[model samples]
Structure formats: C-alpha cells, structure tokens
Target chain A: MKNGRDPVIVGLADSALEGGRFVKQASVLGHCALVANEALKEAGLSMKDVDGLLTAGMWGVPGPGQLNTVTLGEYLGIMPMFVDGTNIGGSAFEAHVAHAAMALREGYCEVALIVYGSDQKSLRSRTLGGRPSVLNMQHETPYGMLTPVGGYAMAARRHMHEYGTKSEHLAEIAVAARKWAQLNPAATRQDDMSIDDVMDSMMISDPLHLLDCCLVTDGAGAIVMTTAERAKDLKTTPVSVKGYGESHSHWAISEMPDLAHLLPAAKAAKRAMEMAGVKHSDIDVTQIYDSFTITVLLSLEALGFCKPGEGGAFVSDGRIAPGGEFALNTSGGGLSALHPGMFGMFLLIEATRQLRGDCGARQVKGAETALVHGTGGTLSSGATVILQKGLQA
Target chain B: MSYDNPLPVIDQDSAPYWEAARQGRLDIPLCADCGKHHFYPRTVCPHCFSDKLSFDTVSGRGTVHSFTISRRPAGPGFADEVPYVVALIDLQEGPRMMSRIETDDVESVQIGSSVEVIFVRATDEVTFPYFKLT
Candidate 1:
C-alpha cells in the first residue's frame, strides 16, 4: 500500500504445481487450471475468493501464452476483477509477481493467482528457427543463428575469450546442480553426477556439454499472492515480496550492448536490491534462472554477487553447491529439475520454501531472505525479485 | 530436424542489407545522427533515435570478438557442417555482427584474430556473409 517503497505490501501465501516426464497428452490450459486449483487449495482459499488471475502464457508458442489469461479464466469459470497477461518468456512469471503486488496494493484485486504449465517434452517440440520480427527472421536468421543453444554457447565462448574462463569453470555449476538434484525428490536428473561426467557428455554446442543445458520436461508451477494484511489470516506463513524489477535491453542476442556488461538482469537486480534496502551480501539464498550454465554465471556477476569476469571463478570449488557459503539454484533449477521452457515461477516457489524453512535437505539454514532472478530470451530480458520472511507488527 | 534450411523472412528494414549481401558487399546502417553503427538493421538509430541512417559499404574486414567452434550441427540443415565456427566479429567501423567463420581450420579462430568477409550465395538472389581468416 506504500507505493512499494516498503517491502511488506504483498506476500506469497501458497502455490500448487504439477510437472515432469509425462507420456500422456495434455493442453496448456488443463495444466493451468490444475495448478490454479492446487495453489488456491494450499492457501485454504477457494475459487469464489479468487479475485485476480496472473500468468505468463505457455512456452514454445509463437507468442508468449498471452491468450491463456482469458482461456484459463473462462475454463476455471472464475469471474475475477483483475487479470494480467504479461509475457516476457522465461522471466514473465517473475514480472507477474511485480504486477500482482502492484495490483494488490492499488486495490485492483486481492488473492492474485499466477500459474504456468507446459507440455514441451511430452510433445517433443522444437521452436521454429525464425522469429516473427523482421530483424530476427531476415536480418539475423540467415547467419545460422537459429538455435537458442547456439546463442548461449556464443556467450560462454565470449566469456572464455575475455576472462580466460575455462570449460571446467562452467562444469562446476552443472556438477553442483546435479548434486542438489540428488536431494530434490522432484528433480528429473537424479543420477549421481560429476564434473568428469559433464565433461564426457557430447557437446551440444562447443564448450557446453549436453549436461550443461537445462533438461526439457513437462511441468507446471503456481503461486498465490495477497495483501500483507490478508496474509495474517491465511493458513500458511507468508513470504513477503520485498523488492522486484524487470527490464529488457534487446530482443535479439546480436544487439546486446556488451556481453561484458550483462544487460537487463544487472539493471533489474540493482533496482530490486535498492528497493529492498539489501545488499548482495545480505541475500541468504538465490534461485537464479539457469537456462544454461553461462546464464547462471552471467547472472551471478551481473547481480553483483561477484565482480565482473569473476563469475567463472566465483562458482569454482563447489562454492554454490549445498553447504557452500553462497547458495544458488537450490531447487535443482532448470538445470536438473523441471524446466518446461518458462522456469521462472519455480524459482519463486523454491525461494519461498527456503525463506519458510521448508526445504528439508537443500534448505539454507536460517534463511530469511532469498533473491530470485529470471532470464528470458537469448539473455535479452531479465527480472529480479527479492523475498523476505514476513512477521506481523 | 526436417528438410529445408531456415531462411530469412525479408522485410522493408531488412531488404537493403540482404540486397547488399547479394552484391557480395558488407553494407550496414550507420546512424548519421549519433555517428555510430548497429547490426540487425533498424528503421532508426538505437542510440540517438536518429531516422537519418545510411547503408554504407565498408571494407569487409573485422576482428573476431568472440567465437565458438560448435562440434555439433546447430541445426539439421547444417548437418554436413559439423564442427563449424560461429563468431561475433567487431568491424573496423565500430559495430559488431554475428556470422560464421568460413575456414578449414576451425581451431585457429581466436578472439582478436583478423577476418575478412566473404559472401556465400544461398540462393539465386540471396547471399549470406561469412568470415574468412585473414
């Protein structure tokens, strides 16, 4: 209610999710409704009490799932006063939290529900090479720049070129993520993983092994938000939306201002932490989007957790693994856990658990604050949200 | 994973760049207002928002800014071109662009290595710019 100045206006009450390794066919809308119901149930709230709908449209579609806001609202048959159909790719859900908080504070709605579900794996879908935009389809696509994996690989290669970052530095992240996935029952890659194992995997692009890329799986995640005042009346403890911000520098990777200076994520994190009155060192846990190892490395340095060109070194020696000084992607992340294309929502879900002292084996002990960062497109856009444990006055 | 290579969907903003490529030349937009260059040709300047832009042909020479020797085919269309090098080249004219380094020795492409542009005719009228080690 304080124009988002204070970090206590909105809190995530509950979330419901369904995902992973599906052999049967299902639509994006069905997953949306299922997660919405489960999320509301966790909050001990019903369809009648739901007043707002928030979601990033399904992934792999030509456009972000912008249509689902209406189809989902109609399918659920919930007449709501508020609906947000914003879509910015993987980080769209993170931006939704910012929108929901502003909406709840402005009295546009209470009990905002955000949902995401995708069947990319079940369908074995591969997004077409061409982007609808003239620049992508015509200006850029002809250069063999069709694959997102190739774009990210170029980034890693760039880092290596600039900072003397070795493939082993990136391999540490994959190995650490797999280590955490071993503890997460829901993670898809549960096999015992090692740096050698990652190194041995066939190269998808030069410098990135198959294991270095995020797993493709069908999954959904949903979370609920409400005014801080109403959170006191909810069944579960509230995780406050202390600070959040989103920004985009360019839609295509070729246009990024400078790879050395990571756009969007750097600016978004600066704004989020500035609003929260917290420093990078104050963060107890991090749930950064990991579409690839380079994404996480760039995000860490961009978010000011480490200095520029030091991300590859900062993540070395198992520093981000469980029981390390700095905790990152504690949910196994898109790397090993469920990644149905848009994996931003799950970052919040895991961050909330860490803040709530609920992550059993992977929990950061006494974690009171968690920073969630999401990267969309070929590192084109970014969103950062800081969450802290809520206590009544 | 299927047949034909993913081709460009040419439009107004892109026609000139494609046209110049077919002529075996590197013509990119240089903003007359900000006096800078940019890639993925745009209607106006990204820096100064200047509509006064011109497609100037420059010496097709640049240095490798960053590169990856992709051991796997980036697309099924490139299946025969496995272990190719894709690089972002910084032109002498102060703009960077992404293209493949067309060379037999993929291992020789390094950051700061000099490269010269070469045109590969993709179609009767369409050509794609590639980099050759200088």
Candidate 2:
C-alpha cells in the first residue's frame, strides 16, 4: 500500500504550435530548452533552480541512439541529482510525472524538471522501418499490420464484434473532442464537425476514420515539480499529487490476452482511486489520452467512469462534451490539440490548469479533484494520476 | 515508388518459423521443462527461460480470439491490399498466433468463432500463414 505524496506541479509551459516558431528542427534537446525555459518563466524561477532532468527518446532524429537523457542534461547545463530516459511509448511523460513524484516523496531531489518534445511531423515521416522484435513489430507487422492506427483499429474491431459497437459510437468521441477544440483558441482542429461528418471522413484504418486518430504535430511541453512545502512559495497555486498507479499488460497488442478489456488500465485506475481515497463521483474533471477515439472509450470503461462496453454509450449521451456534467480534455486533447509524440505531459498540464480554474471558457465548474490517464504502446501500458486542489504537508 | 518486391528478412531467432512456413506447416516451440507452448518462435521458453524446446505441428484449428479490419494499407508494398483483416487466433494446442483473417465479409467473423489455418506464398523466400472461417 503506497501512501500519497505531496509533489506539486509548480510550473507548466508549452511552445506555440502555429507558424513553426520554437520547433523547426528534429533535435529533442532544442525543444527541451524551449519548453523548459517557458516553464521556468511561469514559475518565476530559472534553469539554475532545476536539480533533476527527465526526457523521452527523440524519434525524429535519425540513427538508433541520437538523443538521450544524459546528453540532454549536459546540453541544458543543469547538473541534476537524478536523470531518467525511460521510453514506454507515448505514456513516457506520465511515467516521468510519477517518477518525479516518487523521487520527491523519497527526498531524492528538490525540483524535478520533466520535458518531452518532438518534430515527427516536420522532420520524420510517419512510416517507420520494420524491426523484428518479439513483442510488437514481429507479431503483426509481417502481414501488413504496421503502424499505431492499425494496432488501435484491431482493438476497435474487437470491441465492435463483442459489444455491437457501431462506427457512430466511435465518431461521437471525435465529435465531442472537436466541439471542445472549437472553444480553445490553440486547438489545431477548430472547425465544427458532426458525427456523420467524422464517419464520412477518410478512413485510415477500418473502424477508425481520419478524425478518430490523433494529429502528429511538432511541439513540446514541460512541467516542473517540487515538494508540497516548497510549492507554497512558488508563483502559482500548487496542484498536489494526490495518488498515482501504473501497470503493463504486454509490450504489443498481439500479446494482449483480451482485446475487449483493458486489464492494466483498470487495475491502475482502481489502485489510484484507492490511494487518493476518492471515488468516481468525486472527480470533477478528467484528461484521458485520446490518441484514438477507441482509446478514450476503452480507458473510460477501464477507469470505471462507466460500465464495461458502455463507454460508447456514455460519450453518445454528451457527458464528456463541452458544458456537460463531467469535463474532459479541456485542451482539446491530442486528437484536436497538438500531438507532440509523447503527449502525456499535455494531459498533466491541462489537468493542472483545470484544477486551478485557469481554463477561462473550457473550465469545469468548481473542479476540486481531477484524474488523468496515459496509455502507451498500443494500450500495452498505462499510468493513472489523481490531483487535488489543496493538501496538508 | 513502386510498391512491389518487398522481401522478408530472416534472422537467427525467426529462421525456424520461416522455414516451417515454407514447408506448408505451422510450427510453435513447446518447452519440455515447463510443458508450455509459446508463439513468435523463441529459442528459450518465456515461462521457464529454458532453451530445451522442441518444435511441434499443431492441428491448425482454433477460434477467433479477436480481429481487426485494417482500412489502411500496411506499407507502400501493400497499398493494393487495403481493407484486410488481421486477427489473433487462439490455437487449440495452447499457443495464440497472429495472422491475417481470410474471409469475404469481415462483419460475419465473431469472437470464439471456429477457424483453420491456410498458408499463402507471398514471395519465393517466404510463405505466410493465414486463418479462414471454418
């Protein structure tokens, strides 16, 4: 039984996605500086205040080993007490948040700066070389089952087969996300769209339309975490790390025992809630990773937000839409918002903003407790973090 | 770009499975120590981590655990084969295999539905296994 830790999100920052300002190259280290500088500015601190640095592996750069954590730390001129470069797919950012929280609780470091950035869209093509690994690439890629969209499409197909989930049910999730994006000025997809329109759009993978998939954008996001006691003296309100949990079912979708159920996410969510000592009803907002529409539905069901296989029905009732009972993805999520490869940092930043009542038009009413879920590697791994407005040291 | 002549590279780890596929037989490694079967063709059993393993031919009969219809082409070479079905078939012999689902209508394929193995020769060097509704 792990108790709660008081790691506060003292600073949050992200570079502009429009006009290609901060990110024009494929270097992960360059984007790290952009996001880290913004976060320091927001905290009224400098790079000298950071003692720890964590980064995700750069995908856009060529060669096997281009960007790593130690190299990133050396370039940033910050000699930290701890350094991490754990890549568990896109959810690496959420894992970094959990790592920072645990390090703070154990008194490993005073301030941990977690950063993730990518130029996948501008520099690298979406297509990747097929490497034979026992986990994902070897199992399904041989028969033309490559790419994340295909992997997620396979999961969506299984859900439809078991529960009779229609394409419209999946489209409703996209519709809701686009609606939220319309309210956000920074959202990439601001155009209004209907469920039918989403269904009629270009089909990338059967059961998953183009709208169902997330955008691949060149962007970067960063967050600075400190102990709860030190957070009080910071510039912004501290959103305490109430609870967190993580689990991995397998490394690939083929190794997943059951496609209709997300066991790891369910187990992680249950443990997170138990540690936070809060129920589903206590959560005023949620920021689930929306790499695909099916991901949100599966995560919603796995997190106990709704009954199993009822995730398709839950979103259809407009519950997760803007101005609905429960606010979700106020930043428009990865679907409509900018997807910077490892987009989990954006989820944490949005959750912190929502809990602090900073989302002017997309804010949830009186949000006290919030939940954020991050899924990585074809739903193979997941991490859940719970946040609250105030906490006692 | 001409989307043709995509070759399957064989490494030491997957050489056995590829050789078996060329012989028109589906093979999986069964560990004698742990008495368990595993997929993706590994030298050591994932359960007990023992290298003492033997290859065995299965009945090639199983049920569809789950499947997905890929609307997008897998790569430049597979652009013509869009809207193909990829499935995870649970073999009766205890190992699950990942293969393409060969059925006219993907809608009719149900979970736990019966299926059997069929091999297709993709190139001279490699032959792949596929599953079809029985």
Candidate 3:
C-alpha cells in the first residue's frame, strides 16, 4: 500500500452549466472563484486553507492576465506560498496537477488548488486568427492559415496520405463523441449525429468539417489536492495521483517532429504509465482531449493504445462510442461537451468523477483506473495523468 | 501601396532572410557546423545547436508535404482571399516551412506536388516567399 505521503486529489468541482450555458453570467475570474469555492467546500475546506494556487487561461492578455497566478491569488484573497501560472495552451492544467503533486509531496505546499475559467463563448471573443502576429507567430500568421483548425486539417490530410485513413474514419470519432454527449446532461450538443452528418457539416478547413471541431462554451473547473493522510478526514473519497508527465515539441506546426504522429504525447504517456506501474490493459476509462477529431485519433496512437498509424482503424465500428470496449471522454469530451477555450481542466475533472463513480449514465462500470491526457497548442504540447481510486496498490 | 495582407515582422535574427527576399531571393539559414538548412531563421541551428550559421540562397524548390484549404477567411484581413491553399513545403535543402501554394485551381494541388518559391512583394520591406506548383 502507498504511504500517507502520497499526494491525492481530495476535491473537484466545476461551475454548474445547462447545456454549456451558465445560469449566471460571470467574468473569467468570477468563474474561477466560483468553482474554487465549490471544490473546496466538497473537500470540507475553505479559502483560508488554500496555501497553493494555480491557474491558466486566455483572458486579460496585455493586462492583468499576464500574471494569472498573481491576479487569481489577489482576487481570491489567497496568499499562496506556491503559485504556478504555467500556460502551455489547453494542456496547462494537466501540467499544473503534475507540478502540484510534486509541491505537495515535497512539503513545499500542504494544500494545492488548481483552477481554470474562460469566458470566450460568453464574450464572443474567440477568433479564427492565430496568436498575435508577433515573434514566432509572425511566420504562421502572415500566411492566413486558420488558427487551429487549419493545422489539424493539415495533419488529418497527411494522415490520410500516409496511412490511407479516410474522412469517414475521422468522422467516426465525432459521431462517437456526439453519441456519448447524448448521455451527458451538461453536454452542449446532445442531438443525435451520424457519420454522414459530420461529413456534411460545413468545411471550415479542407478535410476538417465544422463538426470535426469542438464546441465554444464558457466553463470553469477546479481540482484540490493534499496528502493521503489529510484525506482521512476529508468529506470526499481521495483519488490517488499515481503518476503524471508533460512535454512539448514545437510551437509551429511546420516544426512538428512528425505530422502523422504525436511524438511528445508518446514520450509523456510512456513516462506517466511507467511511473504508475500500469499497462494499457489496466486503464478502465480515459478522458482524451478532443479539440478536433484528428486530435483524438493522434492521441490514441501516441498513448500506445494502438500501434502507430492504426488509430483510424482502432476507433472504427463503434469501438470508442457508448457501450464500446473503451469508455473515452465520458463527459462527452471537448467535442460534444463544453470546450470553454481550454479543455484540459475538464479532462481532469471528468476523470476524477469517473474514478469516484460519480458519473451516472456515462460512467464506466466499476472504474478504478482512469487515464487523462490533454493535447495543446496545435499538437505541440502533451500532458498525461494516471489516477486510481483510494489507496489501492 | 495598397497591399492589405498581414506582413511578417522582421527581427534581428530574421532580418537577413527578409532582406534577401526583398531582392527576390530565397535565402534560408544554413548551419556551417552541420551543413544543414532550417527555416524561420533562428540564432542557433535547431539540429546541432551551433551558432555558426549563415543565410544562403538556395534553389527554392520543394514538394508539398501537406496542405489545407481555408474555405472560410482566416480573419477580416484575409476576407478577400477566401478558399486559399496553405501548405507545408518540404524544401529541397531539407527543412519544412509553412507557405501558401498560390494556384487558380485549388483542387489541382495535392500532397507530393512539386513546387518552387515565388516572391510576392507585400510592402517596401516585406516580401512573402509564396510557392507555386512547378
């Protein structure tokens, strides 16, 4: 059995939403505080007990958002000794959890709180352009490639050229995500969808239809962590953070090590699983980030769930859909569920919920081990975390 | 004097490359140590991390590694150029770079298509090294 010093997630909460619509309007920071309070309440703790604060988002750039941890700490009245504002696109939260785990285990912080909130949907500020045409972005932005969709489209097209992966293979992923969304009440898009429907959606970028992309919604999620000994008195069942790892290869799509495969994800997943002493067969559920259908396909291959170039075949014939052998993105994922700008925080939240048996219709039966992975910044960054129920070895 | 498309911001590290482009030349950074070429001009060689680098004008020939057709305009600035082709070009000197494959018939462009660099003068100081099917 693991000792008491092992770091475990004691609380997890997200802002209540009905079909990705917040009941009440709030600023990005407002959403952050709302979710943080609820998560702390669930853990039977309060703002006074939070000694570490971590957050990341695409808000207030050119302003206070630059110092996100400091801005969030001031807003929440948290004088956290340990703060992390590391933002590597959407996968920032998964990396934050890895950082928090080390901070908790090393006695740098007693209680760690990681939060993420975004108002992109509410503010209607989401843009198709890439990051500001400055620095390294100057090379990509001048050419007018659609910010994210175009990059994924290039990858999807290349995957087809190399592995003979067809558009239908990618559409199956979107269709399956929508099928899972139909079971999730909070999912933004619950309507039934077919492969034909996905293929028919407007082509934002060639090879990537409208449905291939994730939804734009406003959301915030929080996770609270402490040592296993402190969890003995908490109200919620502590989910052990067995292992975690993160890596980024290149910011520019052209500089990616390989277009057909995700090298960083392969490295990150291998390290995390090895540290957890688990194998592919030991994983019961997963919450893979679905920024785009191709994202999921590439991620599955990188995670070693299937051989390279076999992700298309692996996800076909209702394999990852509802009642499929693999329960992937049980919260409907960023595809059908709420995307909220950054989707990694929700990946962590959903995996924790699945491990606690909190998911009702979409729950994996007797799920004990859940693997959550997040892909960020045009397939540039990858972070993986392996979680298990209680203190089981 | 009416070009409205976005232009690349030339910096200290990338100034020489842009200067060569203004002269209608495709100059890319070549590492003197490893004898390798790279794109988007960096101070150090990405392959061998060598500081001994010089800008060299090459044949400006490449193959289309991958591409995407932006059915919708990327932004308001690109509103007039709807349904354009953006592609990653595998340069003959061995380094991949992102560029637009300018063509009247978008359907004709495909992976492995042979392309050669063509310069488009956007402004007094900036010239985009666009690619066209050979």
| DockQ (CA atoms), all models | 0.56, 0.49, 0.84
For model 1, the DockQ equals: 0.56
lDDT at A353, model 1 = 82
Give the C-alpha miss distance for residue A359 in model 2, angstroms. Answer: 0.7
Q: Any residue pairs clashing in model 1, and if so which?
A: A57-A65, A58-A65
For all predictions, the C-alpha RMSD in Å is 2.9, 2.9, 1.0
The candidate 2 chain B region of ten consecutive residues with least summed lDDT is B1-10
lDDT of 2 at A315: 85
Candidate 3 lDDT over residue span A218-244, tens digit each: 899999999888988999988999989
lDDT of 3 at B6: 71
DockQ-based CAPRI category assigned to the predicted complex of candidate 3: high
Clashes of each: 2, 2, 0
Prediction 3: B-chain TM-score? 0.96
- The ten-residue window of minimal lDDT in model 3 chain A covers A16-25
Tens digits of per-residue lDDT for model 2 on A14-87? 87777332434436567778789889778777899898788785553465335577677877887889877777
User: CA lDDT of A4 in candidate 2?
Assistant: 40
Instruction: Name model 2 segments beyond 4 Å from true.
Output: A1-5, A19-27, A60-67, A128-136, B1-9, B47-52, B103-113
Ranking by TM-score: 3, 1, 2
